[model samples]
Target: MISIATALLCTLVIRSVVSVRGDEECDASAAYSSSGGKICASERGDGYGSHDVIRGEDRMIPIWWNYDIDQLFEDHFDCGQIIYGYDDGHPDDDHDDDYVDGLDDQAVKEQHIKISDPVSETELEKLRYQWEILREKYVREVNIVPIFHEVKLDSATETTGVDGKGGFVDRPRTHGVSAIVVPTRIGDAGPTKGRGVFATAPITKGALVINLDNGSTGLFKVGHSWREFAVSLPREVACNFIEWSWVQTVPPSSVIDEDIRNGLSIFIAFDESNLMNSADWDDVEANVRCGFPPKHEGDDWGPCRFHYHATRDIAAGEELLLNYGDFEEISQQGWVDIGL
Candidate 1:
């Protein structure tokens, strides 16, 4: 489904060159046939120079949630102009300086030194000024997910058991509410085992572990119920959503009231939040609990909202676990269960 505009926008033209045989250049009529049907090839030369055309790969970069197609086009166009149009201003010794001798000296110099029209040095600076803003957004959106790692506690913490016998246990085991806890994983016998979040740093009780804000948690197929949306998608796509998404409850509000009854909204964690493993409700293994941000007087609740806070102090390198409750129940559906 890639369009012609996509191809043009993705390809960058670096330089132009022509292949020559000895002292004779290929005639215009034969040039197209000689270079494998490409008038401007990207291969360099042995006395026959060629264009350095480069095409960007069709890969995805994490972008802001609020960005649209128009904004992306504008930013890409501006960035391309700024990057490709830049020159070091070094003089070419191969060119003749006498060509400009009789011309308006100042006018020619100005023409040579000026940047591309509509994009001036001031505009570049202005774009540069937005670097911090973009960086902040990137940090909040991308880096908000904690690092996923696996750790074996080889160097166990030393402690005296009830009989006063020295024993090795997990180190620095602090027990209390934590202020923050990053979305982490642990190796345990659970439904969603093998995947876990490991803490690279110590997290205090009552600390914010990970905030799966609306921007990061993608609301997939906004339907009244999970079954309704899952049935509409293709088999594989529907299964993926069923496995990864949480049935989030969007309370009745002015912004959205369709889920007024028992129906809940479906959302998938576009980030690493989806990788978190669940713990049983009766177990003490669950250290973090999901919560929504406090609503202000006018603040509206969107279809997706979630954040995990540490229920107790979590030591560095400890694996984080959550009691999924009914949030993860939808994953129970299968090809036969959903009649796919």
Candidate 2:
């Protein structure tokens, strides 16, 4: 086991490798923010507030944003497969042949995977401290997650964004409409002016409502940071990450940024998730829930995912109202840098 003294020493040394912020493409793990040259500074109020280490087995990470990836793909094609981050192995390494975790045909092969328990409370706290102070500089940015739907399209909607071919297009493009929730503006119905997410039909409780893909609908098992484009990101990206998101912390990704402890926040830069209104806790319209499959889930292990599920039987016309805590407005008391 690593000694505590050695670990503390390592933390300072890791932080010393900060990269000067610039408009150039960021390495994600090595890039630091401007001003004090930290990943994010609450004192400077970079819009990313409170590096408070709130720990949980599946704690929410309001960290970075990931969008504007169309340029990465050589061509825009049908990512026909269910959107998910492949683990260290084949894309389907996390599930068996009968089913690709929960994706019916998405898994590439069948295999047995070991099961691991969720991070224990004690272990979580220990990790929280180590990652926060000693973590490498990088913000796991989650700008958009594609919404994969099973229900049929009720309207004349078809795939938008890229040519529906292959490869990537860019941010703000669409894979199509999600069968899970529909975006319909409910003007001043209650306390919101944004579009409300409603059910396409009667959705069963406990159903897998979302898959959490960054360019698609919601963010998946990726850790991001505001590196290359912090100062130049689109306004939509700003609203999703810093303005209307519940940032969650990322555990050490052994496969990706093992040395970097990043936080992740997910929401569409331009979708209904950015507009889902808040409701009372006892009478929630929907719940922004996420889960991680066991070790058996391998590549499918969602370190963190943004999934909105129905808390109760919701009617078709009823707007999806999530309990955004005691006062959704109170969370933004110190919104001096919310530029979006």
How close is every model to the real structure, measured as TM-score? 0.34, 0.34
What C-alpha lDDT do the candidate models reach, one value each?
A: 0.37, 0.31
TM-score (C-alpha, index-matched) for candidate 2: 0.34
Residue runs of model 2 more than 4 Å from their true location after superposition: 1-189, 213-230, 234-241, 244-246, 250-270, 281-306, 325-340
In Å, residue 64's CA in model 2 sits off its true spot by 16
The best candidate in terms of lDDT = 1
Q: Model 2: per-residue lDDT, tens digit, 1-340?
A: 1223322221121223232223222245632332223342222223223221211234322222211222111011111121111223333322233444654443322221221111223222322222221111112233222233222333343322221221222332212333234334322223223234555566555455544333333332221222223322322222223333333444455657642224432232223354455665235434433444333534543444344444446555666665554212354331212211
